[model samples]
Target: MSRRVLIKTLPLHTNYGGIVQAYALQRAIRDLGHRAVVDTGDPISLRRRVLHRAWAVRRAVRMLLPARVDWDWRASREVLAPQQSFVRRHLSRASAVERADTRRGRARLARRFDTFVVGSDQVWRAAYAEIPEQFLEVIEEFHGPRPRRVSYAASFGRDDIDEYSEAERARATELIRRFDAVSVREESGIGICADAFGVHAERHLDPTMLLTPGHYRGLVARARTDPTPAAGRTLVYRLDATDDMLRAERAIAERVGAPAMELLPTASPGSYGEYAADRARFDRPSVERWLASIASADFVVTDSYHGCVFSILFNRPFVVHANARRGAARFDSLLGVFGLEHHRAGASADGIDDRVFTPDWSHVNRVLEAERARATAYLVENL
Candidate 1:
């Protein structure tokens, strides 16, 4: 039987992983014969919107000024605009619910769906945990016939559970207990949920892994093909680009005898060195463009989790740098899944092998198939 399923996750345009994972999960649900929709709930306050407008105005002024602006403001706008437009045009299918921050808003919205999913990202983290709608706090507190509340691959963003205050921990415990079924993205998250909520949560693959590489190929095929795609080049997709990281990327590129190219974030707020500035830069890459870049790369160096994910999917040789600020648990869990823990790059770029190392795809695919089956089973049974 088909049911109306509503998924609540981070904002669609926040980053590539968030957007792709949201689309992947919704697609997976639809593949299972249910009508799925991503609920881009209205949670931003009016004050924040005003501040955003003010920032945009300031940026526009800076772009028009005589002083040479290092930032590729026009490129960033061009890249990001199409991405948002893609989501609005191709990804989202349901009319979004307005006023989701209040009880009245959630109550009104709940009546429209038979089930609610909170997942495929850091929805369980402290930052979004308090949001009644995102964490299913509203569904847990619903007075009328409550919709089926399930969490799929939800990450706490860290291994430690002590980050929450005593009251907040209590509330989280209460809310999580009300979930019909809870699945976490990382293995560590299972323990955190168990320790904090005294509830056992299953470990599931990230939504990106839920789909096969062939499914992603379709998206890449649709992307506007690059007229002059780079060959035998190292594609560096770093979320936290430090001076040392940039140096390491250059060294690797030199060792491999390939040019170094970077996929610039839509809103990276840092200065690049002369070496980095000299290399090619892809600013504000759309999801399709991002996928195509990774698919065509000879090798990849990245600190982003999804970066690691697509590299694996494409069966590309890649190195994952430790992103301490974003927490290492995500990488640890994912790398451990594919038995690629040795792929983690050290602090220094030296001793990093120059040649592309082939992964054991037969084994990797087996593991992926098993995890995919388990995750899909959970969703099928729950929803």
Candidate 2:
């Protein structure tokens, strides 16, 4: 029998991984013969909306008012426009739930589905600790039939649960105990659930990993009727771009005798003014183009987790720069799973050239196949 599954995660965020993970999970669920939808409607108060705009204004001022302006507002828009479009066309259709902030609102939302899922990202992180009642979907004193609650690959962002206060922690533990089934993205997250909440959460692969490379290839190919063939060029996708990382990318491009292409942020433009302008004007690539960029790259250098994920999926040689700001546990756990620990690059360019080598696909594919099955099985049994 087909069941309706509603997934609640941090999908409204602009991050590529966050968006893609939501899409992947929904797709995976549907592939298992169930109807899956993402709860993209998170009720934001007027005050929060005003604060968000203020934050954007501040960031824009900082990026634009610099002495030698390193970021371009228009260029950022060009990069993000397609990504936003992709979400609208591909993801928004499944988003039927309305914004629910109050108990009444949540109950109305809950009545729409049979099962509610929280996660595949840092939905349980400390920053969201205060809203555990909503984001975690554990409402109190409702007379209506309760939906089965579960978490798939939910992460805490960090290894420990120190972000929550003592009171908050106690409340969170109580809420967690209410989940019918729980799973985490990282192995350390499993420990966190056990020690912090006394909950035995299973570890599962990221949703992006749940889908095969062919699934992505088909999506990208459909978006681009006239696909750009691989030209053995170096693709640089940096979420947290740094001077050292840029230098390494340039050096690698020089060594390979191919131009270095970058996937810059739509919110924070980089210092490459002319390149940014050119991309904004002529080569405004959408999410499809972004995927194609990674698919056709001869080599890739990136700090983003999804960036590294696509590189591996396409079987491209790549180097991952450590992005500690986003938390290293995610990268460490993922790399360790695929046995690609040596792919991590240092801040310096030392031995970087030597680090670029084809991965052992025979081993990596085997691991991915097994892990994918396990992840699918967990969802099948739970949902």
Candidate 3:
């Protein structure tokens, strides 16, 4: 019997890692003979919301920019205000509406399935949340008593329970205990949940790593582009901004005599077209094209989680930059799983002198196969 599975998360909205992981998981779930759909836990159409958000972001950025051209109080305050109580509350309410919208959206998507798999990103981040009650209520309504509640690759990221007050920790623990099966995307997360939430959960790889590069080779092949290797320079790049990390990438490229290519964010005509702009970079006679372009890259330097995950999958040497963002500490734990601690990036590129490439695909592949089997079984048995 085909299982109806509703997968939930705050869709990548703009991040490449988020999109790839969500799509990979959706594909993997579908391969299990189940119907799986990604619901960003919000009903708001991101495409429609982009213009308003872009304008808001522009306003915030402009207000925050210093008059003297320095990153001073006025500029910092504008950027910092979003973290204030009033702004947080307003954002939370906006999110609640979005979640309610997601619930309404799910009603149409939920009709075809039986199980709901929730996760693969920082869906529990407080900044992105309205209220716990509002969040939990939506979860229960759609994935209530009947369908098995499986947290495929959920993460709390850097927000440790210990950091919260005793009451908040207890409350979170109670909420976490409700899940039927919980799996985190990093080993450190397992410890966090076990010690903090008082629940033992398995740690799994990002969905992108679950399938081999060959599985996605066809997609890359279709988007093949003329090789753009810079004589001796290799491609060094990142998703978001990181001066030190980008510097490190340049250092590596120079040391190896390779030019670096950085992939930047592209505007989506619609949410579904997030990868549409990138489509040109990977086009081929028969392949999806974008995949091919990424595969052809000599090396990758990125701070994005999905970047590291895909780099490993494609056998590309790369560096993973740590995010200084408040809730993104999970990167450390994720890299630890692959024994790639050396690849971690911080504020300064201090230690890594001239190491060119270090990746253990053999061990990574074995672990991936084992976890994929377990994840696949969990879906099949529950469905």
Candidate 4:
């Protein structure tokens, strides 16, 4: 039986983590022979970061160059809309569908989608100071109770729901009640929903776990078809990653006696051409090639949860650098989930340690599969 499904998430169409989550869910829905349409609430909104015209010009220039090219057009517009009317107008003009989400427009929009899956990122944070009530208001108007509401891999920090303010707790309770089922990404989230919202949300794995490393191997193979780092070593880093982390990666590569290369998730074709121009010890590969390189590397050093998850999945020894900017506490919460304390700290030049590299994935896999099955069952029944 085929049915239409709508997915609402945070930071969609940008970042490997967000893309992988959205892609995996949509893929799962499609595998079940359903029509899944994923549309996220704007990351930038009237209550969020305000974007300015000057910033827009600077951003437009930045997008044209290889440096500071990690901008996600969607995320940028969402985070900066309140501050920059020019950017809001700019992206709004470019996007025909999302721009019409006015109070008068929402009623008609609600009639279109059969079910809405709201989750897979830091959207729960909206209950905090950063977001406005309108965000939930719009979603509630579009996806009311009994319309097959489900939350896939949502998360809250280690602190209990009592940690939230009265307004936030009230909002959370109401939203959680409206959902048919809510599945969280970490054990902490279960406590949060139960204690704070008075709703029962089961603990589940991040959607990235739904697919095995073997499933991602095709992109890896494609990435390695012609690669200089294929025979040596490589390090993939996200934009927010620090210089110290890169140094640790290089030191590990050097200790292993292999040349090292850097990997970027998003870059222009011409940037790849520039990287190709450099015949030095370091070489850049396509994103697929980068993932392949990590799979085939002497060691992997990253600040990404997916990177850490996949490293363990592939049985590769890795170092997960704490992301200080985003808050290492969240990383700590996730690391605790897999019992991977050794690989969960700040970066160091330490050579690959077998103990840290080796985790009992056999046990982890069983837990992960059960969560995936639960999530799948929710989607299947809702449809």
Candidate 5:
């Protein structure tokens, strides 16, 4: 008996990790012989599209005001073209099917699926984005009072629920209690489920890690034209640009004995230092090219959870810049899985005690295989 499962996660955007996770989960579901459907994308109205374009132009103009604000809209536009092209090529098959951003649209979309899944990102966190209150409404739009509802690898992105307001806490508690099954990407999220929501949530690996290295290598193979980072280059894929993260990145680069290839392109105004140049290079590579860069890099240094996940998947030696501002506990939880916790670095880079930069791949692989089995079983049982 086949079932149509609708995955209700974050919208597909330019974020490499987000896109990859969505792809992996859908692939994993389909591998179990279940049919999975994700909304193609939200339909932006003409008025909103005009406002977005206007906002982009206004910001671009403000950046060009005198202080060498270090921004370029042309570069941004050019960079986004390839990123979107990647989506159209790889994800459009399963995803280019629905766009439900309205009441009638959601109701119509609900009629096409038998089950609904909500998860696999910082989507549980209110501040990650301005996700509409109606994202959960799709589940209720079903013909019955209850439709199969599961949350897979959902993350609150923090150690505590104190960030949510009183009303938010109540809403989360009520909504999560309705979930037939619940699994979170981070260990801390388990505690959040118990303490904040009174819901028992199992801890599961991020969907990206559910796939094998060969799976990612295949993506890279298909993207043959995408240039990878130069061999022996230290890939610096930071999500946050704190002074401590920069120091941590430099130290890892030195330890790896290679020139650093910084991949992220975000910098705040008036910030000085080596990362200042990042603002001018906002053209983050296509998702496939980004994967290629990580796969080929001699070593990786990152403050991103997905960065560490990809480094492990690609067998790249790496160090984690455990930036507290970006939820440092996530680093601890991810590294703990492969016994690579020593690879974590603090603001001053002192927390990193793993002198031998590389982990025991044999040990990590064994752990990966075991965890992958458990994670897969979780998907199977729930599906």
Candidate 6:
């Protein structure tokens, strides 16, 4: 009953949603009385790898200079320090030996973890993949005496496979079939799995939805200086804030009679010199602080998948700006989960739709309670 579990997900870093979702799944597994550790230190993109190496050399020379120059490496270390610290504090991580990418490495991995889970994010999207095999390497690379493989709420980012080539689709089908269980985060994903892989996949909640809002509030309370319980404030969280989105946020704030706070990406790149040294491109809120902003908000308007997730978890009345580029199908699937798809709409100038702010909390909670039970049952049966 007490099996060791290894969680395979998008590399934990600045992406708040990615980090929180990974945290949620691992936490969920451990709460079930199983040992779970998330695998970290994943390979970076080729461009980033090259940039990091260049920065390392520059940093070495700058350290010896009369006037020290702040490079990306040092600044990045500062920005990600809190996030790294959070992972260490809140989650168990695989040691380097257990995370090795070699045959011997996987052997060590197989010996430690009885089951491997790839999930709770866009793990199957090739464009989003850092490692060559993407998240599929858990099964594709480990050849001998493989661990039980499961995909919990794994997403291809979109229902359409326009970005996935014919070859990638073929390989994905092969790797997908190897999983003992498969659950997708979107209803549209269920059909994609059936049609593409010829395997039945269940639609499940995003891992963050598995936990209660109180659990997240507890995290917010841990922050030393992070503000929490923001009363009478409308939170604007957008991946790409267009003019329309901004106007919508302003209108929503005006209508609600609450001040608006824009929560932009703290991890935006391009910081150098004294200005970069003195200030980050944006204030890098600790992981808990980021959650606190959402947890405490009176209302939220976001284009992010995870933004929508937290709003629902906190039972905040909110509308999503359909981010079709990142994956609008996910929004469709997520809102459809609570039968609240009308909650997503374009933020046009004429007016922000009335449905954006009026939500039936009682009905949403009823659906969430039932869905959480179904999702937990799937996890219990699998891990």
For TM-score, the strongest prediction is 6
| Local accuracy of candidate 5 as per-residue lDDT tens digits, 117-201 | 7768777777773333313544454353445677788877888866677877777677778778898888999998898778898
In order, what lDDT does every prediction score?
0.77, 0.76, 0.58, 0.58, 0.73, 0.78
TM-score for each candidate, following the candidate numbering: 0.84, 0.83, 0.69, 0.70, 0.82, 0.88
Instruction: List model 1 lDDT by residue over 231-336, tens digit each.
Output: 5789898888688888888987876677887776424424333213532343466677777778778888899989999888878888889786876788999999
Q: Which stretches of candidate 2 lie over 4 Å from their true place?
A: 43-79, 92-98, 128-135, 255-257, 265-284, 353-356
lDDT for model 4, on a 0 to 1 scale? 0.58
Best by lDDT: 6
Model 6, span 1-383: residue lDDT tens: 89999888877877889988989999999999999988755633557656878988987887576434546665666667778888879888764332455666656767777888888788877778642355445445555677788889988888866678788888788887878899998887888889877999998999999999988877877666455545678888878868887887787788888998777643554644543545645457688877888877888878999999988888888878988778888898888878777778676625555665778888999999999999999999987
Looking at model 1, the pairs that clash are: none
Worst 10 residues of 2 by lDDT: 92-101
Q: Tell me the spans in candidate 6 whose CA falls farther than 4 Å from its real position.
A: 41-68, 95-100, 130-132, 138-144, 225-229, 265-281, 349-351
Q: In angstroms, how far off is 215's CA in candidate 1?
A: 1.7
Residue-level lDDT of model 3, residues 1-383, one tens digit each, is 77767776664433445656767787787777766666664545667667668988887787555454443334334322322322222111123224344655445334444665667776655555432431243444565334466777776666464445565556667767876778777666787877776778887777777666887775444435343332233544455565666677777676555677645422212321222334444221222233444566776766666666666677677666766463456777766666666776555545663442756768867766777787777656655
Number of the candidate with higher TM-score, 1 or 2: 1
Residue pairs of candidate 6 with colliding backbone atoms: none
- Candidate 2 residue lDDT tens string, 277-348: 555443445667677778888888899888888888778888899687776787788888988988888876
Task: Estimate candidate 3's alpha-carbon lDDT, on a 0 to 1 scale.
Answer: 0.58
Roughly what TM-score does model 1 have, to 2 decimal places?
A: 0.84
RMSD per prediction, one decimal?
4.8, 5.6, 10.1, 7.6, 5.5, 3.6
